[model samples]
Target: MAKTKKLAFICYPGQETFIEPIVREYEKRPQYQVHRYYTDQQADVIAAVKWADILWLEWANQLTAVATQVYEIKSKSVIVRLHSYEALSSLPTRVNWKVVDYLVFVAPHIRDIVKMQIHDIEKQVCTKIIPNGLDIDNIPKNKVFNMYDIAYVCNLSLKKEPAMMLQIMAELVKFNPAFHLHSAGGWQDKGCEIYMKHMAKEMGIEENITYYGFVENMETFWPGKGILLSTSFHEGHPCNIMEGMARGLRPVIHNFIGAKGLYQEKYLFNTVVDAINMITEWSATTPDEKDYRKYVIDRGWTKKSMMASISKLIRLCGKKA
Candidate 1:
C-alpha cells in the first residue's frame, strides 16, 4: 500500500462551507488522512499541526495568524487560502507569510488587494488564483421557467449593497408587476437588515419580495428561481451566483470592481437601469439553461477541478517539505 500523508485543515467555526468539499475529497483518497480543526483552541490546533505533514489554513483571518505565528510548523508545509473579506481586514498583515509555502486567492483582484497591503508578498510566498468551486453535478438544473422570479442569494451586509437590489426590483415591477425577488441567506449586518426592510416597504417592493432566511436546501429553493441577481459593491468570485448558474438560472451580476475580469459583460450590469433592461431582455427571450451551466464548466469552477488544482499544489509542496 502507498504510504498515507497526513493533512490538517484549520478554520473558524461555521466557516467550513468552502473547505468541507475539499476535506471530503481528501478523506475518500486512500493516500491521505485528513484532520479538520474548525475551532480556535490552541492546544488542539497545535496538536493537529504537529500530527500532519501539511497544514491548510482555510481563511487568512485571526486563526491563520495564530497558527502561522506560534505553531511549531518549520518542518511542515503550510498553505493559506485567502477569501475576499480577509484581504480587506488587518489580519493578513498579522500572518507570517514567510512560513506559508503556498497562498491561494479566490480572485486576482483579491490577491492584488492583499499585495498592495503586504508589499513583499510576492517574494515571500507563492500565490495562485483559484476561483471558488461549485458541486455542479449535484445542483440539479430543475429550473422552473419564470423569468420574472429573480433570485438574490447573499447575506444581507453593507458591501452587498442591498438597496440596489430593491431599486432593480422597483424598476422591474414597473415593467411587470409579476416580477418578484426571492432573497436567501441570513442577515449578517443588523443595520443593513433594518434599513433594507424599512426601505423595501418605503419603495413599495415589500409585496414583490420574499425573504427565505438562511436556506439550508438550495437545491429545492433554486429550481423555481429564474434569474440570479448580485448587486454587490465588490466580491471574491461569489459561490452563490455560480450555484444559481449551475441550477440553470441566468446570472445578472453587477459590474462591480474586477467584475469584468471574472465574468463576461453579458451577465454584468453597471446601473439599475442596466439591470432592469437585462432582466427584461432575458424575460422576452428563450431561457438558455445550458449556456449558464456551460460557463461554469468552461471556467473550471467545479469541485473536481478545484480539488485537482489543490492536490497538484499539495504534491509540489510535499516534495519541497
Candidate 2:
C-alpha cells in the first residue's frame, strides 16, 4: 500500500482563492490526500478533524470553537494562518496554543500587531510568516506602457480605503490629463458603493474613475494596466500588489506600516502627492517587467514553490509536535 498523508483545511468560505491553489497542488501529489472543511457546524468540524493527521485552520477565527475542544484537536497537528482583520478579532485571545503547534501570519506586521493583542499565547506558539500562494505562470508578461490607467485591486470597501485612491488620482490628473483610476473587486456595501460614486462626482473626478464590480478572472483583467496602486490602511501583504507585479504593472503601494519590508522602498509612499509622483514616474518609463516577475517567483511566492514549502512545513511541524 502507498503511504498517504491526510490533510484537512478548515477555512472561512470567502477565502477560497488562498485555499484552492494549495488543494490543487496537494491533489497532484500522490503522497497526499486533502480534505476541505468549512467551519459551519460543530459536529461536522469535529468529524473532519478526526479524519486528518494534519489540520490547518485557514483563519484564526475558524479555531474559535475548535480551540475549546481539547479532545477533538488532540490527535491532529493544528496550524492556523492569521490575516490582518483577525488580528483585531476576539479569536486571537481564544486560541489554545497547546493544541496549535504553529501559527502562520501573512505579513510580519500582522504577526507583530496580533502578538501585542494576544499577549501570553503569542510566545507559546511557533510561528512562521507565510504569504498565500500566487501563480503568475499562466499570466503572460504584458509589461506596462507609459500611458496612464492606474489599477487598484481588492474589495472596494471602506477598510481598503478606495477613497484614498481617488484622492491620489485627483493630484495625478492635475499633471497627466490622461490618467484614470480603475477600482476592481466587490463593493461590500451598496451604501459604500453609492457614497464612493457620489464622492468622486463631488470631487469632480467621476469621469476619470471606473468601478469594476468583482473581477471574475484576473488573467483576463490584469493585462496592460499602467500601475498597481494600493491605498489600504491595513493589509497582510495585499495579493493585488503581488498580482499586479506579476502582470508587469508598476506597484505604487501606500505605506501600510510594513509594506516597505515586502517591496522596494522606492515603491512605498506616505502622501497623495508622493503617490501621484510615483504614478507619473512609472508612466514615463519602461519598467523592468522581468525583474518584478522574477522577484515574486524568487521569494517562493509562486503556486508550486509555496505549495512545496507549505507541505514541508506541515510535515515538519507535525513531526515536531
Candidate 3:
C-alpha cells in the first residue's frame, strides 16, 4: 500500500456547499487521510498546512491563508481551486501562484477570466478543469414534468440576474399563460431580491413566479418542472443544472461567460427568446431520458467519476493513490 498522506481541505463561506461532496469522496480514499479546515482559525489553518503532505485551498479566496501564512505553504505542495467570483475579487491577485502545484477550475470561463485578470501569474502554473462533483446516486430518480412549471435554482444575485430572469419569465407567460416559474434559493444580501419581486409585480406576473426561498432538498423542485432555466450572467458550474437533469428536466441554459466551451450548443442560448424556442422545441419532441442521463454520467459529475479526477490530482502532486 502507498504511504498514507494527510490532505488538508480549507473551505471559505459559500464554498462549504461545493467542497462537501469532494471531501466526502476524498475521505473514502484509502491512500490519503483527509482533514477539513472549515474556515478561519489561523492556528488550525497553519497546523493543517504543516501536517499535510498536500494542502488543498478549496477556495482561491480566504482559507488559502492570508499573505503571511501563504509563505508557510511554499515548502509544501498546494492545490487551489478558483471559482467564478474569486476571479473578480482581490483573492486571485493576493495568491502566490508560484508555490501552487495545481490550480483547479470549476469551469473554463472562470479560468479564462482569472488568467486575464490576475497579475504576474507563474508561467508554469499548472491548472486543471475539475467540475464540481455531486453524489447523483443519492438523488432519487423521480420527476413530475408539469409542462407549465419552469424551475430556476441559485441564490438571487446581480450575477444571477433574478430581475432579468423574471422579465424573461414574464415574457414567457405571453406564449403560455399556464407557464409557471418556480425559483428555489435565497437572496444574496446584495441581490436586490425585492427589486426583482418589484419587477415581477410591475410586469404583472408576480403570481406566475413562485419563490421558494432557501430550499434544503432541491430534488423536490425538479419534479413537475418541464424546463430547468439557468440565466446566471456567470457561474462556477452550478449543481442545480445537473441535479435538474438528474430529475430529467430538459435544461435551458443561457450563454454564461464561458458556458459554451463546457456544455453542448444544443443547451446553450443567446437570448430569452432562443431559450423559449428551445423549450418549445423540446416540448414538441421530448428527448430520450436514457440519452440525457448518459450525457450527465459521461461528463464525470458523479462521486465515482470525481474520484478518478482526484486520483489524477494525487498523481500530479507526485503522490501514490
Candidate 4:
C-alpha cells in the first residue's frame, strides 16, 4: 500500500471558497490525508505547518506570510496561490519566497504584477498561471434570455466600481425604460453602498434596478437573468463572469486589466457608451445561447481541468518533499 501523506490547506476564515472544492477532491483519494486549518492563531498555524508534508496556502496574505516564516516548513513543500488583491498590496513583500516551491497565480497579469513588486520572484519560485475554474457539468443551464434584463453579481466595493455600474444602468434605461438590472452580492464598503443608493435615485434609474443582497444559491437566482454585466476596475479570473457564462448568459464585462486575454473582444466594453452599444448591437443579431457556454469549455475553464492541473502540481510537490 502507498504511504498516506499529510496535506494541510491554510487560509483565513471566510476565504475558503476556492480551497473548499480542492479539499473535497483530495479527501476522496486514499494516498492523501487532508486537513483544512482556517485560523490566524500562531500556535495552531505552526501545528498545522509542522503536521503536513505539503501545504497549500490559499492566499499570500498575513496567514501565509507568517506560515512561511515557520522553521518546520523547510522540510515540507509549500504552494501559495495569489489571487488579485495580494499582488497590489504589501502582503507579498512580507512573504518568504524562497520557501515556496510553487507560486500559483489565477491570472497572468497578477503574476506579472507580483514579479515587478517583488524582486527576483521568478527566480525564487516556480510560477504557474491557472485561471479560476467552474464546475460546469453540474451548473444547470436553465437560461431565460431577454436582451432587456441584465445581471450583476459581485460584492459592492470601491474597486467593483458601483458608480460606473450606475452610469451604465442610467444609459441603458434611456435607450429603453424596460431595461432592468438584477444585482446580487453584499456590500463590503458602507460608503459605496450609501453612494449607490443616493446616486441611483438622483440619476432617476432607481426604478430600473433591483437589489437582492447576497444570494446564497445562484442556481435558482440565475434562471431569469439574460445578460451578465461586470464593471470592475480589475479582476483576477472572476468566477462570477464564468458562472454566468456557464449558464448561457451573455456577458458585458468592462475592459479591466487582462480582460482581453481571458474573454473575447465582443464580450468586453470600455465605457458606458461601449457597453450600451454592445447590448444594443447584440440584441439586434441575437446569437445562440450555446456559444456563451462553448467559450468556457474551449478555454478549458471547467472544474475538472483546473483540478487536474492542481492535482498534478500537488503530486509533484509531494514527491519533492
lDDT of each: 0.87, 0.77, 0.75, 0.89
lDDT tens per residue, model 3, 1-321 = 568878878775555877777777788878878888886777777777778878778778765636225556777777888877888777877777777888888887777788787634536478888887667778654444666678888888788867667767777788778888898988886438768877788888988989899998765566777778888887877788887776677788888878777678888888878887877667655545555566678888776776678668876674521
Score every model by TM-score. 0.96, 0.92, 0.90, 0.98
Q: Which ten residues in a row have the lowest lDDT in candidate 4?
A: 280-289
Quote the RMSD, in angstroms, for model 4. 1.1
Judging by TM-score against the true structure, name the best candidate: 4
RMSD of 2: 2.1
What candidate 2 gets wrong by more than 4 Å, as runs, is 62-64, 67-70, 143-146, 317-321
Cα deviation of 99 in candidate 1 (Å)? 0.7
Cα lDDT tens digits for candidate 1, 1-321: 656788889988899999988898889888778898999788777887789888999999988888887647877899999999998888899988888999999999998888788988888899998888887777778546688888999988989998999988988898899999999989999888898899989988899999999998876677777899999998998998888887888899999878888788999998899999999999977578888888899999998888889989988877765
The number of the candidate with the highest lDDT is: 4
Please report the TM-score between candidate 1 and the true structure: 0.96
What are the per-residue Cα lDDT tens digits for candidate 4 across 164-276? 88998898888889899999999999888889999999999999999899998877678867788999988998999998888888899999988988999989998899999
- For residues 141-238, write the lDDT of model 2, one tens digit per residue: 77444449777788877888877887887778778678887778888878878988888888788999887878787666766676888988888867
Measured on C-alpha atoms, candidate 4 has an lDDT of: 0.89
